[model samples]
Target: MISKSTIDTVFETARVEEVIGDFVQLKRSGSNLKGLSPFTDERTPSFMVSPVKQIWKDFSSGKGGNVVAFLMEHEHFTYPEAIRYLAKKYGIEIEETQQSDEQKEQANERESMYLVSEYASKFFQHSLLETDEGKAIGLSYFKERGFTSETIKKFDLGYSPDKWDAFTNKARDDGYKLEYLEKTGLTIVKEDKKFDRFKGRVMFPIHSMSGRVLGFGGRILNNTKKAAKYLNSPESDIYHKSKVLYGIYHAKQAISKEDNCYLVEGYTDVIQFFQSGIENTVSSSGTALTPEQIRLINRLTKNITVLFDGDAAGTRASLRGIDLILEQGMNVKVCPFPEGEDPDSFARANSEEEIREFLEENSQDFIKYKASLLMDEAKNDPVKKAGLIRDMVNSIAKIPDNIQQEVYLQECSRIMDISDEVLYATLAQIQNKEVPSSSRQGKQKMEVVREKPVTTPKVDQLYILERNIIKILMLYGNEVEDFEDLLLKQNDDTGELILEPDVQQSKVFEKVFLDLQEDEIAFSNEDFRELYQVLINRLNTGEEFEIGNVVNELEPSQSKEITDILMQEEQYELHSWDRHDIPVKKKEQAVNQYVTQTILNLRRHLIDRKLQELLEGIRTAETEDERTDIKNEVVGFNKLRTLLSERLGRVM
Candidate 1:
């Protein structure tokens, strides 16, 4: 387990802008840095990083958090993984507490698989550079393919010995259990014997977006007609090929910077393009493109230009992938190399400038490309032409944005010599058929109004007041304030009760805690109640208030809620009343008044709820005497509500 002090050190040392800026291109926007959201497809910037607050907020996706939270969300990392990542980034030496055997036994299975895969990657790389056989075969092959030593090292290219149990034996010698080796697909065990899975193949390590080795793709060097040329690791706990794209770790920054991604087909294609200066590229790793793969690219950029070889199979793959990209609401383009040249060969033959120029000149919009490719086959046959038109319309309907769909429909109309009206009608018909019966029923239900059941307004009001109080406590709980307390005392001469007000200085948290305790009030919401107790405990123990400290102690969902509260200021800051020349009261200036009103409102809400219960009891009373007693109780509660209302300056 990571020590609390180490987590705190990591959080303090890691700067929000510096961390996120490694993956995102952030331009200065006033006091914050703004960029397009890495989580969504958008041209305009809605993601803001505040260095002063050490937090970030993506307006497009409504995800906002501190540096560690960002890593957890973006990389799908566990809490420990995020902490370790930040610790490494900020050069903080982590101090961990020793765990018992039982605790160590409880280590996550996925993390274990990650460890084994990382070890295997290292083992393969070492073999490639250190072993004579590896150097003679794998190193020679990579060098012949025009891969530089630097490129090979950057991509973590490696080799496995041709022996059956070379890697398996080495891993066992290193004290790595054969169980995990088999789990990561590094070793294939069959009937009392184990062997390396990628024997004699040059290895391409596949990495997660955070650069952890998830799996490997190995290319066989020896010409064997019975064996496949390229082999990938089987699906494991840590690696799902459908959910991963090769070279995404290396290409993500470039993709976000260029606001476009170049999709290729193989590991060599990605490496060659990256080495040739087009770094914003990824491959499906030879698998047929899936929606999951397209969505992965969609997260970084809305535009995808698929680079295909001149072969007929490559063209067919591009056709299949284009519709999937459009389905995800991303713009798809096709860039085909000259006949007999793939991304690998083309990149190796051309200089960076020539490659860039050829890509620019050959790239065409997918809609246009599709139209051109299918038009020839449909010539002079009205039925075939009609089928082609329907195919185009189906692809058009996959687009979520109506404006983009309309533009494409018009383009299709101009090319196919059909009217836009016909295309619109066909799209409507297609969309209508796609709507499910349950969804239509839901729409109908929304259109019809139903009588609302009786609800406790006081309870709802109290919840809001409780949330506001907690928000204030989190923001300004440690500040000292002069708090007014109302006291009841006996008059000296008349011997009658009189209300006296006393002002006392105390921390805001202390004042709020005392006020709520005096009224015996507790938060109605369970989360708020729990947080309130934690804050009170911290205050009582003289712990200083820090948002990051509180967030670290919270569960992820609660942390997100706290982040939402903290980031509300940034969201509101974007809409400055000063820009409109309107007088707006600052929150700090009215802190005392706001706190007092929030407490009074909560008290008044509780009183109203008690009065309502008394009224209900009165209606259900079996005798007149019982009803009278309930009415008397209601009268006292009403008087308390009136007093609270008076304090809040409300006529009730």
Candidate 2:
């Protein structure tokens, strides 16, 4: 377990901008930075980062958080994993408490798989870099392909020895279970015979966008007729090939910075392009591009440039990914390498500048690319041309953005020599036709209106206080106020006034915070609980209570709650106007002040109600001591009510 001191060190050391900037291309927007949402595909910037507050919020998908929380959400890292990640990034040494066997067993299956995969990756890398046969075969193959030593190391390229049981034996001997090795497809076990699955092949360690190695791709160096050209790790708990994109871990930063992703095929293509200084490139790793993989890239960049080889199969396959990209609300451009050449060969043949220039000049939008590619086949056949036009419209219909769809329709109309109206109509028809058959069949409609929970005067009063507490949390959670003294009478025989100083030394937020702390009030929602806990801790540590940071720490639901309060229609301008030059009535300037006071009044009322409830509960106890406590609390609640009325300029 990570100690409290370790967590504090991570928070103090992990700069919000540095951690978020690794995944987002944050351009300065005043005191904050803005970028396209990493949680959703969008062109205009909605993901905001405030360096002052040390938090981020993505308005599109509604996910917001500090550095650790962001990593937890975006990379699927556990709390400890996120802390460890930041620790490693900032070079902080972590000292953890000892774990028992039960604690080890508590690691989730997915996490366990990830740990096993990481272990296997290190083992493979060691075999390649630390052994003679590995350097001689695997390293030599990569070096011969124009991959630098640095590039090989950066990608964690490795090789499995040709001998059977070499990797499996080593893994088993190192205390790794054979079941995990087989599950990750690192070893092939048949009839009590276990052998290395990727024997004699150079390894391409495939990683998640967060840089955790999920699985591997291996290319055969041998030309034997029996051996396949390439092999990849089988689908496992942590690795789903269809959903994984090669080089995303390395390319995410560049992709976001450029707002573009260059898609390629094969492991060599990814390595060659990245080594050539084009860092925003990823590969499907020779698999047919899946919607899931495209969506993953779309999260980082809205613009995708798919590089296709010259072959017919490549062109045909490129067509398959276009509709998927359009369905995901991304702008896709196709860049086909010269006939008989792939990205690897082309990048290797030409200079970086030349290759870059070629890509810039040749990259065409999907509408144009599809039309042009299919135009030859359609030739002068009216039937084929009609089919092609309909196909283009169908692809256009897949786009989610109305404006983008309209623009594409215009472009398609121009390219296909059809009318814009005709294309739009065709798109609508296709979209309507594509609706699910299940949705059209047997629909049972139940009109039910749930009754709103009855709100009593007590509840309303509590609601107001809750608002004030939230406001204080959002605005002045870190402020410390001097304790105020109040006089209270607590005797029957003598009219004696007891002087009680509010030794709390806390702001309004801190008062509510301390109350919750004492009661152990916990949020039921996971993300909300995390945000609430972190904010309280920050406030306690004398760290500035940044609204942005608190908002960012919240998960989507908590973000919505914050947004509803901060951005709602509670305040409006009071204006007077006339048709002529003269105004009918004077404009009011106290609108905002009134709103603020009303909110504060409501908040105070809520707190008073809660205090009253607590007092009443204490009174019901049969003990004299509890009764005495209730009497004291009653005084406090009365004083709170008096202060609340004073704040609103009302006489009690």
Candidate 3:
């Protein structure tokens, strides 16, 4: 376990840009920095880093948090892992109690294996680019398959030389541990001899979601019947073929944002689709789909569209994996390629829009396509058609949702020309056949699938307002600004009423705190309310407000929330401004405008709520005095709201 003191020092010393710069190439932009997002494949620089606040934000994916949060998001590191990474970078000593030798040895071994794999990957890439044999063979093979140089680099595609001991000799010369090399499957040691496992092949490094190299998959270049066409790293401590999906490290964010995952059978298919601008795709690494791999996609989304190869026999062979997906309660769609075409070849041939449109137009629900596929085998035969019905019913019985089960059953009736009653009877029989209690896996119920994925809904106004208030407090709370208070006046000559702005100078925090008290308004969000109290209490003392100090003391989630609020460039979360009216200005120049507008907006909301309360009180009045009192209160709120509306230039 890491000590609290060490965590504080790491946060204090870790520079967001410096650490992130190690991974992402950042260029200076005004007071901050900008770069293409490491978390996404982008053509422009949309990721931002604020050196002043020690935080980063990715506008491409809409994920922003502090430095440790960047590692957790970009690298998929656990909290402690991120902390330790930062500590090591900043040269901070972690104070943890000594552990058992077994525990320490296990942790060190895993890390050493990861390091060895990383070295091997880099070595292979260097060979692919720098060596004569690699370029003539491995690089030529990739270019022939229509992969670009940038695509090759992005996936770290590499080549292992044909010589038996080339890689092993290089790794040993570099002082890499022999045991680690053997464990990571980079070097095979047997009978007091050493040789590279992936020699004479083009290598594809398998990565974890955080981009750590876990293993490799190599494709042999020669036509040798004695050797397998493809070789994968054997199941080791870190690399489990059944548990990891290829390309998941790069495909995770797109899968979540699109709420859809394209399941294919090979690495090249995933790479081709990604190059074609469909980033939400992964492969099963030529292995059967396992529950653990399904669970990985389920963590990001429930929908999976399995892209089938053009070969009919290959398509038939993959149906068992689809059935496994159905049993796991995942929504499944299937799209079969035309004869003589697969995803790798088809994606290489098609443009991005054409490929996307094809997927949208051609993908069918699992039930429809499976029946169409099995019907080819039935061929108007009495016995085979019966078998088709039985097959469809068995797949339907795997579905856990009652509505989905009924809908698919009805669909089967329509397609097979069988009665719905007969289909339901067959389904019941299949579901009722009981196995041993210990052997049965309970199925989980999932919601019905949507026709299209929905983007996140807009956050409500109250949340936006509260976020604004705390944001202002965290950023400009101690900075002195001149605020305008709208005052009403009446002219004696024409009896015309007018509003005047009475200007006064005060710290931004004092005006917000005192004005909120004058109206007795409190934050609706519990966390905001607590943080507001903390900022106010600290600022109330005649001392400078240090945000870093406050953040260090808070829980991680709370600190991240406040950090996001503080580092935001756009302050008007609720108000979408027009350039013709209130043009965008630097935060320094817009402080008074924003502070006044936020307070006025908060007042307007609270006054409207108070007016509603008073109106309800009038409805339940017991006597004329109570009704009169409520009406007077409502009238006063309405007048004040009208003034606030005039100041904010927004009708309440």
Candidate 4:
């Protein structure tokens, strides 16, 4: 049997156009090459080959396939013969029969490239530690950056010697295929020439969450305007810069343990924080923060604290990334270093404890951080300040959680000392613009709706809230925990508003039942309404609620509804990542956040509907007293909505 690695190498090196060009006189036809059908007597060009897709089609003969398939069809060769032909033509080493276990492990092209990357990681580390040029340039740079020897080895820090073919020639000599080296972006191959992509650069191996090296981020140590300061592996089969996080392999456990992850901009920031004993840190590798990357962190923790450089201009430029975090349902905080300092510089100056303390004390939620940053510059100019306020409103509109959006708007109002009406009006305008919500980089849910000729999804907000309430009751109905309750009270002394956040321990069902009861609300969906009562009755018995027992008594449709409600969160979890892809330790499900948010969302949904009804009544009322009564009820509902908004943030 031909080894899978050999097959993969052959495929990688054998270009479809080049291989077919040997037999067919192909000519450029737009993006593809077109020639007369070789298998049939056709005067017009009917054989078309695409270099980009690496496949060919003979329209006249009705034959189509890859390079190897083409060889098998045209040259009357067997599968093995075609493989051998390409292997010999491309100079790829071919292995056949009696394959070793390691050779058997290479299943596909992507897997083979991964092995090449792993070897390259080791090669670079060896160069850093053993080579004279590597030690002089790379080792000296790290020492100058204050990276301890232990930290250096821990991160597998490495150096690529300053020569075009230093690493490339070595990789080839050691039986690592040039085809894979090129695919992994470690070597730039042109015609018959190839050279190391990161020559003369310090290599930081970017690892998958399972600790397998995916690619490299190479840093140029010298002051050279000719090259990028940092060069990343080009997007490949195994590596997507937007989807991977630097230091995530080392920081996953720490992030779940600490219940937070510190996000920075560069590789050294993560390395410095890790060395400073703050291992719960990661970087986007100098790229813009991405939702995929945020989602990668989301599996470990909901909280992300982004460490910003002291330069306010840079902060303002990337502050737009904060919206990505917000849209993905992640809580973001920002901590800016003192003027002219960054994570690397500050960590060098401060002790481990001071570094940790500084992060703790200085970190502010994104709302406060963004408002303060914009308010500073815009404060000096009235027109710019108006633009700043609108920009802030744009961010506030991106938040998916209604309660979170309301809370953020209130925060914005407090910071600008502007009335809540203005911000809320701007938010309403933005939300009602009829523009489809979408992201350019992501497989957007909106794009899916727009592109497919499917009926628009009818989202029932109230029904979703009801389903969520049932889900919460099903999971934590009998469990007791401290839940923060917001109570709006009038201060007797000064008649000022005082919101007291009372932490009360109660079973989850009790909290859900009482809140709905207090609001005089019932599930608008009959199924959820009926199921809610049944679950509450079971929970009220003071015995642990067994879903099995309750589900057994229900009708088939009701039972399925109940079952779906219980399993819904798992079924639609944002990050249902494969264990083989990245074995991230699972964080405990956030029972409290889910429970409280569901209840608040239910309240807001019901109240907003009620407010609309009251407004309608006020318009249609036949008498003065009737209109006055409706107006008073509207005031009461508005006040209640305000309290719910305050409780969303656990503050006024």
Candidate 5:
């Protein structure tokens, strides 16, 4: 319901790089920026952003769009919600348009759940800051943890009263359906009875990376043996534990800026680290690591340091996650707290410098951590020792980079006192082997399948000539000058050489390229065709074409092509470093260079064949006049060839 003007203001004010950089750690790639794919787990950067285009594209996911689309895709926000988010971020005043009650009633269940969750977050925050019990318990708990009032407001910390049906009755009175309340896990309903889900607990709302409240994690204040220490919102439509990382919304910028992520296991662990001046930290929330979670971190950093609880079981359980990180091409290091300590306790005990120093000194490669922990169990037992070596080799094989994998293998060999060759051989075998016999058979069949051949129509010479014209248009479509050319015409009464004034063209590219533009000029791939059309549209609109915008619009495969085209090479050198430092040719000079060369090359090939025909006719001449004419034509053709070759810079 936000006004269009407000939306435009937000879009214009919000810098694409700045907004995306909150989640993506971007590095300069020529005129654009590149980063690891956020939509997929990747070690290498395949996601691109163009400040000029104000858009982004993930080459691995084949999803490209403007800032709004990224928010929608990454956070699963409805269009309205995304606009509202931008408006809030940019401090724009949102003026809602009138909507019919009937139209408003048509909102879907998922959207209703989002609405309910948002309302619940606000209600809890209000309760915490505005009520006595909440102030004494929830506010005090946060203040005791060193969270300032601004930080508390920033995170929207909240409290739910001991009254069970307080939230439920309030929501019902507000016209939010009970179904949505249950769907968002904010209210529990049983056999004609409804009550709040987190009553009597201090609230910590978990947010998606886009800052939408997905769920909540609540802590019980009163010590009671009958009550659980902590409770979380059950899996709902918007919150998937395996895919969501707590504190990511707040910590993403710090994580990306540092180029490293600190992975912890609990909500408090993340908050404490941030409070202690370590802001690049997120929690898995005690869940086993998932690929989706790994990709989320991968988008911001290629390096991750896991802080494990000092307990032996906690360390062993977290060791498996290292392989997942390795598979995604991330550099992982492990830091184990002292016995019986977690990140929360450890941070509370030391100063920021002390905590940092401890991490720096103790963080070791995952392979080394695994070997160090497991080697003792296998000591003096040959079978167990061999088994441990194989386990390390398997973990090494999961690494995508050859150099990194080899390095890990060498380290493993040294640590286990095994031969390096043996470890290498084992890793190679593990990598080459298929997942299973059935899967291998299916893959082999796919590899053996051959494509059928098809004939294609030959392009007319004019078509090739036109293609050259299109290429020129794509390269230099914004020229502000005109080009002049000679034109020949025949008078009505007599055929003769005539000179006429030819109006200078604004841009030869726009005139010629658009003249030949057709909706039917299809590409083999739809995405390529889509990208080509977008490029043409941008050129026709007299706007500066952005290769990143096209990349964002195209499929992932086609996006790679667009990115490669824009970033492949400089394509033209401005000036060479030499004595006197002469400047490169001006725009007009560059255009003329391209145009004159192409025209002359085409003319040379055409005339060279014609000259051969003229010489052949000299041998077949039946009359002296014909022979003389043929000789004259041959001389003229040779002269034309010489002129063209010179213009084209070719020795003929």
Candidate 6:
């Protein structure tokens, strides 16, 4: 466990903009930096980083937090991992509390597997550089493939000696247990034998977005008909091939900066293009592209230009990935090389300028590419043409944005010499056919009742009030203020009740806490209640309120709620009356009014709930005594509600 002081030091030293800039390309937007969301597929910039507040917000995905939270979300890192990352970035020495040996042994299994994989990656790299056979075989092979020494090291290329049990013995000698070695799939253990999985091959380390080695892919040099040409690590707890895109870790920053990604088919394809000055490229590692892989690219950019060989298999793979990209609401283009060339071969044969020029001049929009490829086969065949049109319309339907879909459909109509109306009708038919029967029935029933007005439940209304109160407490809780307290007293001489006000100075949090306690009010939501307790503890300690520190200390869900409240844009400057030469009241000027009203509204809501409960009791009363008791309770609650309403200047 990291010490609290060390965590605080990291939070204070780590700047949000500086930390996020490592992964995203942010341009100045007013006082903050704005960029395309790293969490969603966006064309326009919606991710904002505030250096002053030391926080960030992705409006596209509704994720916002301090530097640590951004790491946790973007890298899928644990809290400790995020902290350690920031600590390393800022050069802050971490001070951790010592754990017992037993406790250290019981650390997470996923982390254990990660440690073993990392060790294996280092072992492979050392063998490639230091061993004689490794240099003669694996290093020589990579050099022949046009990989320079710098590029090889940059991608962490390595070698596994041909001898079985070589890596296994070294790992065991280094005190790494065989159990974890097997779990990470670095070593294969059968009956009483253990051996290296990637023996006699050149190794490519597959990394997570945060650059952690998740697994390895190895290529064999020996040409045997029965032996697999390339071997990947088996599925383990740490690595899922379907969910990961090869080269994403290296290509993410370049992808974001260029606002484009170049997708290729193999590991060498990515390396070659990167070496040729196209840094914004990733590979599917020769697997069929999946939505999960597309989504990974989508996070960095919405524009994907797929590079393929002009062979039939490459064309088929490109066609397969197009609709998946469309479904994720991304724009995809295709760039194919000359008939005999692949990305690797083309990149190797051309200079950086030539490769870039080829990509710029040859890429075609997916719709046009698909049409050109399929139209030749459908020429003069009415049935085949009809099928092609339907296929195009179905692809258009996969697009979620209505405007984008319409634009694509219009282009398709023009290319196929069909009417826009026909395309629209076909699209609607396809969409209708795709809807489930239950969903169709639900839609029909909804249409039948469309005229009914919707009303929010009283409990939900109270919950909103509770949330608002907490928001105020978080934002202005420690600020001292003068509050007008209302009181009623009996005049002894005239025997009349008189209302009086007494002003007192107190912190906003103190006043709100005392008022709620006097009314015996509590949050109904369990999460809200937990947050309230944490806030109270902070207030009791008289600690300076730091949003980042508070957010980091809470659970992820609670932290999200706090971030949402803090990041919400309350000032609508675009619609401000100041533009028309009229002054409007600022929230800062009415802080007291806002706080008092929030409290009164909460009290009024709770009183109304009590009144409703009493009414229900009266309706179900079995005896006169019970009915009378419920009636008295209802009268008391109604009076309290009236008082609160009067204070709020609202009619019951």
- Which candidate number maximizes TM-score? 1
Residue pair clashes in candidate 6: none
By summed lDDT, the worst window of 10 consecutive residues in model 4 runs over: 577-586
Deviating ranges (above 4 Å) for candidate 3: 1-107, 435-652
Question: Candidate 3 local accuracy as lDDT?
Answer: 0.82
TM-score for candidate 5: 0.77
Record all residue pairs in model 1 with backbone atoms less than 3 Å apart, i.e. clashing. Answer: none
Candidate 5, residue 116: CA error in Å? Answer: 1.5
Would you estimate the TM-scores of all the predictions? 0.87, 0.75, 0.58, 0.54, 0.77, 0.85
Candidate that beats the other on TM-score, 1 or 4, i.e. the better one: 1
Residues 1-652, candidate 2: write the lDDT tens digits: 8887888788877888888888777788767778777777566887877676666777788666677778988888998899989988888889899988899878887677787788877877888899999999988877789988899889988888889888888778877777778888888889979998888888889999888989988888888889889888989878888989999989988898889999988888988999999999999988888887987876667799989899999889888888888888788899988899999999889889998899999998888888888788899999999999998888888888999898888988888788998887888788767877675452322112224465643233333334434544565555555534233345566754343433335464556565566546544445445555666676777765556555645655676566543422122112221111111112452322333343445445456657868877885879988888877877877776666555445311
lDDT of 6 by residue, 500-599 (tens): 6788998899999999999888789887898898888887798778776787778778887777756654332334433222222254556776677778
How close is each model in CA RMSD to the real structure?
A: 4.7, 8.8, 12.4, 25.1, 8.3, 4.9
Regions of candidate 1 where Cα sits further than 4 Å from its true position: 1-5, 16-76, 95-103, 436-459, 482-505, 540-543, 555-561, 567-589, 621-626, 650-652
Per-model CA lDDT versus the true structure: 0.83, 0.74, 0.82, 0.79, 0.76, 0.83
lDDT of 3 by residue, 587-629 (tens): 4656878777777777777777778888999999999999998
Residue 355 in candidate 4 has what lDDT? 94
Candidate 2 segments exceeding 4 Å error: 1-5, 25-30, 34-48, 57-65, 96-102, 436-467, 477-600, 603-652
In model 3, pairs of residues that clash are none
Q: What is the lDDT of residue 35 in candidate 5?
A: 87
Q: Per-residue lDDT of 525-565 in model 4, one digit per residue for the tens? A: 88888888888888898875655445545654566576455
Residues 27-101, candidate 1, lDDT per residue (tens digit)?
898788887787886657888887766778887888977888899788778889889988887789999999998
- Give the per-residue lDDT digits (tens) of candidate 5, residues 530-604: 555666677778666644444444554555545434432232253231121111223456564455444445455
Task: Give lDDT for model 4.
Answer: 0.79
Q: After superposition, how far is residue 398 of candidate 4 from its true place, in Å?
A: 1.0
The reply for model 6, stretches above 4 Å from the true place, is 1-5, 15-76, 95-99, 378-387, 418-429, 436-446, 449-459, 491-496, 517-530, 555-561, 564-589, 610-641, 650-652
